[model samples]
Target: MEKADSCRRAAVEAVADVEPPRLYEYIESVLDRASMVPAALTLESAAAMSPEDYVFEDQDGRHCAGESETDRDRTQISEYDSERIVTHAAGVQLIYEGLRLTRSLAHDEPWTVADDDADEGDLAILAADILVARGFYLLARTDAAGKAVRTVQSFGRDQTRRAELEPETASAVGPDGADSAPDSLDANLEHDVLELAVRAGAVAVDETPSPQLLAVATDLADAAGTSFPPVTECLTDLEAKVREQSLEDSTTDRATSATDP
Candidate 1:
């Protein structure tokens, strides 16, 4: 549990000042609910776990502004993005979406969306009531509800995989534990989450189905082969890379806007 606490501490440090106190509390609750809380998590954690993860207004603005150009923005990027509403529900949604994406993306169809676009996608507002409110968001309101159902169904088909996935027992292991990698689909918890993280990253960056995205994730899987510390470090690196990329994108957006008029 020392590892979990360290992960939580790092996570807290990541958003202590930026996110509202309630949101931070909510995020903490979600992590605790997951039962396998890692030491530190990046935005990719949200993406990988909760495909329908919600974004705080400030976070979306940072993504839009590419505030990643500075260190301050980099430090504040992973605020409880998944727990937009109910706290622990983010954990449930993460499982649902990861399974959903693993099933959907397995198809040739594309699930790409701008980094911030998923904020309001049909899938964004889950109608789940298991842990939180049921019927909270009926499909009647979502323009993409039809597509969302397909995605959810796809995830449902493979529910067994999650059931088969073993929990990571060893604490703070790094990513080089190839020998320890379970023969199962995820190899273990970190692998499973990383797979979802990459998939989410692909969709968020509009790079789904791209080999490079998968490659990066695979590389991460190997590096963080099987533990929390490595996972934490991997998340930190991914966050910085994403931030830098966001900064560049923001700069380009500005340049294009200057030229377009």
Candidate 2:
């Protein structure tokens, strides 16, 4: 939880540059509540984890900082896994919320420049900063940091369009063919973040990243829409596929060795 918690705190620190102190404090509090989604996902997975699934017999099924002959730390994690995606997803939500608040000031509306709206805009901008900071903090050190970084950049590009939205452009806020608010954007962003997490996890474990992982992440994201669930069955399937592939590779190598001169 410490790595997870650190990601959230980093987001607040990011707010310091653009948000007022009071507003930063407020966003910090909001962030605390918003981060529970990923945490819950991890806890649920651990709860379901059978002892035979993990390496060490006594390992608590908790996130560890790193792996060594003797990895004893309880507060940090050495491997990048799905949990990082949760932190990143929370950051995405915080940033998107902030952007929405600030976008209210765009298009030169009569009330756009009002004191309250301007203040809201400031807070929104600051919140986004925090999200980005938190994202980089949680992801930059990972093996799949590049994938996550590119995903964040893509999300930023999407934000540009959203932030520029005016009254006439309200249609863009909804999905392509739905009456609901444009949940697609959120789903797509989340999918990318989660996909990168999958890719990164693969790399961490020395597995070759596969197209199926992307497909699984994207499919799960689409299923989630705007309000997604904590974790998904696809994640389990993806892990199973990874394990299955590893076994086949091992068997092939053994057979090849047996036949070699």
Candidate 3:
């Protein structure tokens, strides 16, 4: 009875220490469901603005302007109809950076394990920590994008007219008298690449679980004159449980937020 209890405890503790897999899942979901237009435009703006301070305004009243004055009394101000595009570009970059961190972690070597006999619980804990970190990282990334999108949309919605007299405007009114921003698909592609990289990193981690190490744990338990079945079974069950719980929690939170006043 004592041995059985010990095995059960180890199994439970090991599983408890493993972090839920929902972090990656949530990030992936966001990437999948997000609006490609704004995200792409945002990324394009970030890239274009990398070397200069500029703004975008449209011919149809979607105008954005920026001004910078040198210490030598030279004032450089520019505007465009695509300010929202630029803002979205920056926002997408922020999200990409956050997602990159998780990808980096997924590729990094296990921090807690050195030898074959290391505790399974320790390994599980390390994995859990990585997942938790990823979750927070992605949440921050998505939040930044979300905030920027809202701000940009608000600005676009509030603007009543394009900067008609601004000579710096790149595009002119179309034959149909409609204004359009530059193509933003390139920026969207970059964001998509980042998201894909993140997913790939997660797949790598999931595929590379140290099965040998788990086997070693089983061997060790058997050598200690104990049954290994309970420990292994418990760890497996815990992993699934953690994943399910994390996903459920994430879904619930999203639903609640959507319904909230």
TM-score, each model? 0.33, 0.52, 0.20
Query: How does candidate 2 score on lDDT?
Result: 0.47
Candidate 3 on 7-59: residue-level lDDT in tens?
Answer: 22222222233334544343333333332322232222232222333333332
lDDT-based ranking, best first?
A: 2, 1, 3
Quote model 1's TM-score.
0.33
Among residues 3 or more apart in sequence or in different chains, the pairs in candidate 1 whose N, CA or C atoms overlap within 3 Å are 7-39, 48-196, 48-197, 49-94, 173-227, 175-223, 175-224, 175-225, 176-225
lDDT of 1 by residue, 145-184 (tens): 3333443444444344534433552443447653232323
* Model 2 Cα lDDT, one tens digit per residue, 1-261: 443454455445545564456766766766655533332222222222211133311123444232453444332332343334344434444443443333333323434567886676666566555655555554456565676567767766655654554344555444455423333444556666556545544543445445544454466556666444423333344345444544554566689999999
Better of 1 and 3 by lDDT: 1
Ranking 1 against 2 by TM-score, winner: 2
Best by lDDT: 2
Error of 2 at 80 (Å): 11
Error of 3 at 23 (Å): 19
Q: List where candidate 2 sits over 4 angstroms from the true fold.
A: 1-21, 35-113, 159-186, 203-210, 230-261
Clashes of each: 9, 7, 14
Instruction: Please list the C-alpha lDDT of all candidates, in the order they appear.
Output: 0.36, 0.47, 0.32
Model 1 clashing-pair count: 9
